[model samples]
Target: MQIGFFAVGIGPSADPEIIALTARTAEQAGFHSLWAPEHVVLIDQYASRYPYSQDGKLPMSTKVDILDPFVALTFAAAHTKTIRLGTGICLVPERSPVVTAKEIASLDKLSGGRFDFGVGVGWLAEEFTAVGVPWERRAERTREYLKAMKLLWTEEEPQFTGEFCSFPKVRLYPKPVQKPHPPILFGGESTPALKRVAEVGDGWFGVNVTVEDAKAKIERIRSYAQAAGRDPGKFRFMVSPGLGLPVELDMIKRYRDAGVHQVALGAIPRDAKGIKGEIERLAEKLVVPAAKL
Candidate 1:
């Protein structure tokens, strides 16, 4: 089972030095990947309820200097060689897909084909409205935009036509280093999200699910994929069990038995000052021993 690190990478204490240090250490420690979520701008009043939290309140960390995922990942990419970078989940419907495809494909080219595009339809209604994107038709828009992005990445002279976007054949220089474009992992626990995974995604990324709960979800996902004539075994499972206890070996075994491909440690640092030390401690204590099993 592969292990990864999930970090917010914001706040007063998360300076460049700290981030660099963490990235270097995580690479040295043999962590599989590093993931960070994105929020271009946080909105206070949104009609949609925040899904992760019980109270529908966004975390205070969202209000911090949360660096843009691409820019920050580029900086980290310059600093590390082997450690892959991913958006734990990027809110795609809120941004222009053309712009996003260009940026991410460039990053993938620069990183030597080490990029995973994790996407979601977004939860903040006000953020979508602020960006002039309708929240109601986000799913349809997302599908169209992603299809357009694929055309841009794969076709020499790409063109796209859809309700949300249409473009004439155009050349995008420095096509992605990855052959078919970066692997996309769909994030969310909803039925539509599962269907999206079956149709378009390379993997299903689960959040806040225990091993037992995840097994059921994975089975459901596989059923959907099979129904769509997709090979269920081709779909990877990447889990981020947020705000949880230290991952035990037993938990790791459970996930492995249930066919989880990777697990990102979502236990966050309570003290930003000690984030590095905390991560090192967890890696040494939990991950190292489990890898041997």
Candidate 2:
């Protein structure tokens, strides 16, 4: 039963001082990890439905300044020692795999091997169009790009050939500090997403699932893994439960009972002092009690 916060570098906390303060405070308060969300650019008008909300619109404004997850987490890495850092969901089809691999390897090296790679195919069709990446067959492209990145991370003479990505034997220096690259946690709740978990994921990251949803999804993932000859026991389960806004211990107990390994919370405060106070409150209210659970 570990805990993490959704993001640090956005809105009022986007400043360098605030990012450092948030990271240091969370680590000191006994939080296990810090995560950051990513969106290359938000369109003022888009038709893509935000999966997490009821009105088919993200609750955020287009004016929100979302610092790049890598840059933000790098700030966190330099500021804190023990807190693990992650991209809550890096949209895979939007960037070149080579560039992404290098960034991830560098982050892992700098962070002392504490990086969790969370990835998703993406939901915003318009954003993909604006980024000049195809909106169709993106999941397939995501699968290919990730495998290509794997070759870059793990192979001595890395090479890959696929519909979306291919490279001749080459070298990438400072391969990830983790043995075989950082553990990739696949995000999304679609059937295809679960199948992606079966294909190459080290874990399934459920966004906004309930206790029952998490349980059912975990079982489905297990079955998918077994069907794919993957050992389900080795896969970690992380959930960003949609339960309590000010999360409750009892809600945590339910998720723990459902076999969730880590609970990543969201809607954290945006200002420096508010971030510190929230971490302190969460540490007192949930971190201490949940650790015992």
Candidate 3:
């Protein structure tokens, strides 16, 4: 199984020099990809609980500096050659579909076709309100937005009309190097999320699922794919464990046994020094040995 570092791209470690160093080190260490999370804006308090944590609270402080995933990945792209860059979870429903399509395509073009678009219908209601996006029917909007983006990516003079998005026939230049756009990995654990993946996603980015549960979920996704007349063999399954979970070789093996194609480990550090140390430790102790096994 491939291993990736899930960098928050926030807090003290978000400096440009640190991000560049992390990208270079991870690529040199033979890590598969580097992922960054997205949050356009954060408020001091939120009614929505973070879904990944046991206490439903975010691990980082609200004061932490959050960077735009695309911008952050762009910085990392300039610093590394082969390590794939991904938005761990871009909030799709909050942004304009046309602009996002251009950003995804541009990033994929610039990154030599090594972009993974991991997306989700966001959970922060207050943030949605702040962005003037209605909280209700967000999943539906996300689906429409993705469909719209796909049209923009694949067609020469694409036009789309939907409940949330409408556009006239127009040519979008510099189509992604990867045909039909980048690998779109949907993130979430609900049945609806899995169904969405079967319908449109190239993969599932399941969050915080244990090994035993992930096996069942992977089977379930395959079943859904089959029912939808999609080839289950073509889909990728990836898991990102909860923050603070023990990440040992045995745990990695469990995920591999569960049919996961990749595992993303959170590599948050307090400062630039810690960032380098954490990447080195994970590379030497887990990623390198795991690859040989």
Q: Could you tell me every candidate's TM-score relative to the true structure?
A: 0.94, 0.98, 0.97
lDDT of each: 0.81, 0.89, 0.88
TM-score of 3: 0.97
Residue 206 of model 2: what lDDT?
A: 94
Q: What's the lDDT for residue 11 in model 2? A: 72
Candidate with more favorable, higher lDDT: 1 or 2? 2
- Backbone clash count, each prediction separately: 0, 0, 0
Best by TM-score: 2
Task: Write the number of the candidate with greater lDDT, choosing between 2 and 3.
Answer: 2
Query: How would you encode candidate 3's per-residue C-alpha lDDT over 7-56 as one tens digit per residue?
Result: 84777657887888888988998789999988888878888988877788
Looking at model 3, which ten-residue stretch has the lowest summed lDDT?
8-17
lDDT for position 58 in model 3: 78
Instruction: Report the C-alpha lDDT of model 2 over 164-194, residue by residue, as the tens digit.
Output: 8889999998899998889999999989899
Clashing pairs in 3: none
